[model samples]
Target: MRTARRWRHYLKPLVFALCLAPALWLAAGVRWPAWVDLGANPVEKIQHTLGLWALRLLLATLAITPLRQLTGQVEWLAYRRMLGLFAFFHVAAHLLFYVVVDQQFAWPILLEDVAERPFITVGFAAFLLLLPLAATSTAAAQRRLGRRWLALHRLIYPAALLGCVHFWWQVKADIREPAAYAAVAAILLGWRLYRRRPRPAVTGAAPTPARGSSRD
Candidate 1:
């Protein structure tokens, strides 16, 4: 209980650091040919960066419930909004890199690419879905919308599915990493479904006492 009570103070920083660790590592001059452009393929590097961040965010989102349950930390709910926002940030970065750098902001080329690439279409759809959820994550929006806010936010599940599909579809070889993420997502979604199932109710009928009456 004390751990639960004090969780809010530490949760945000811890989650943020965990999420940013990879990006920070890249920023700190870790120049792997896969990540850095020094004779490396820039497009692949950008894809790798964005894809890792997206998967990390998705995993983090799925982890929230399990972590909260284990820690008895209800206040961890406060971190969800920021965590979600960071996920959106990374996904948007992914999209921007593809659009501006890879496609060079050419609508004709982008349309052709999207049409030719089913994975791109799925990823684009997922990103579009995340936009509204991130936009309405504030307290003001929550208060204004009430139950409807929750209903809209439920799209996260499908968005995550679409994201996983996007990743899976895009990979040509060494699909182990994407498969691992998909497995994790399946387990998370399964856990959620299990939690939501209806429980059997106990009947109020009680057993009668023995027929022999001592008082008589």
Candidate 2:
């Protein structure tokens, strides 16, 4: 029973890895007709697909705290780092696909894309914001940076917001999906604010009588 109970701890990561298996296979040159199109590059589709997963994983990682609090499953905290690293993996893959396959090693084109495309700009900003969080994720960095590290990691909120905007801006129509993500992000952020709000102090203690003994 103990082992079975602990098995639940592995369930999320297992499911995530299983979901990503297809992407990994595709990345390894396993082509699928469902993903191929004569008008669109398969590589770009792969990159976009991976990028979407990255964004979802990032959101999931951010949701851990709220979900744990709501559910009272403190064990959930153990999975957050793994989910975050998986998010970074997918994001890195997306960036590499664009740089290597789409742009053909053209720095000029890459720079132009960042300058002209708002979606790209926001996505880039999100990636940049995640860098410090990822960097200080290690125990050594946490020890070295102390409280400053936590303050820097708080940038995840804005980073997530930028990621949502980047996704929403890229869609030309049928924005419901993006809007859903944005709503979720908003709720998560709102939860934090609500949780942090100061409450009125209770005044239950009876006022102490003035110090005047029977000397009266």
Residues 96-160 of candidate 1 have per-residue lDDT tens digits of 87888777899998998788889989999999898999888777887788778878887888888
The most accurate candidate by lDDT is 2
Cα lDDT for residue 42, candidate 2: 71
The deviation in Å at residue 64 for candidate 2 is 0.5
Q: In order, what is each prediction's RMSD in angstroms?
A: 10.6, 10.5
Q: How high a TM-score does candidate 2 get?
A: 0.81
135 Cα displacement, candidate 2 (Å): 2.0
Q: Summing lDDT over every window of 10 consecutive residues in candidate 1, give the lowest-scoring window.
A: 207-216
List the pairs of residues colliding in candidate 1: none
Report how far off residue 154 is in candidate 2 (Å): 1.2
